[model samples]
Target: MALMKKLTVLAGAASAVSYVRKNPEKVNEAVGKAARFVDEKTNGRYHSQIEGAVRKVSETTRPRTAE
Candidate 1:
C-alpha cells in the first residue's frame, strides 16, 4: 500500500510536468482537476502530495517561452 501510494505520487508528479509542458495555459486548471480527482480517490490521504505535484506544474506553466 505504501509503495503503491509513493508510485502514484511519482507518476502524478511526472504527469503534471508533462501536462504543463504540453499545455502551459491550462496547467493550473488541469492540475487542479487532477489534484481533486487524486485526493478524492485516495480519500484525502495524499492531498499534499498531489498538491505538491500541482504546484510544481503550476510553476512550470507560469514561465513563458521565447516563442
Candidate 2:
C-alpha cells in the first residue's frame, strides 16, 4: 500500500511538472493565490517568508529571452 501510494504521488508530480513547464505563468499565478490565502489565514505570520520563496521560484522558473 505504501509503495502504491508513493507511485501515485510520483505520477502526479510528474504530470504537474509537465503542466508547469508548459504554463509557468499559470502556475505562478496559482502559487501567488495560494500564498495569499495562507497569509490571510495565518494573519501575516509567514507572509514575508512565503513572498520571498515565491519570488525566488518565479525568478528561477521564468523563461529567459535573448536581448
Instruction: Compare the candidates by lDDT and give the number of the best one.
Output: 2
Instruction: Please give the RMSD to the true structure for each candidate, in Å.
Output: 8.2, 2.4
- Model 2 earns a TM-score of 0.76
Q: Which digits, one per residue and each the tens of the lDDT, describe model 1 over residues 1-58?
A: 9999999999999997686678787767866887898899999999888888988877
Q: Can you write out model 2's per-residue Cα lDDT over 25-65, one digit (the tens) per residue?
A: 89899888999999999999998999998998698669989
Q: How big is the positional error of residue 23 in model 2, measured in Å on the Cα after superposition?
A: 0.7
Which residue ranges in model 1 land beyond 4 Å of their true spot? 1-22, 64-67
Worst 10 residues of 2 by lDDT: 56-65
lDDT (Cα atoms) of all candidates against the true structure: 0.83, 0.91
Which residue pairs in model 1 clash with each other?
none
Q: Show model 2 residue runs off by greater than 4 Å.
A: 64-67
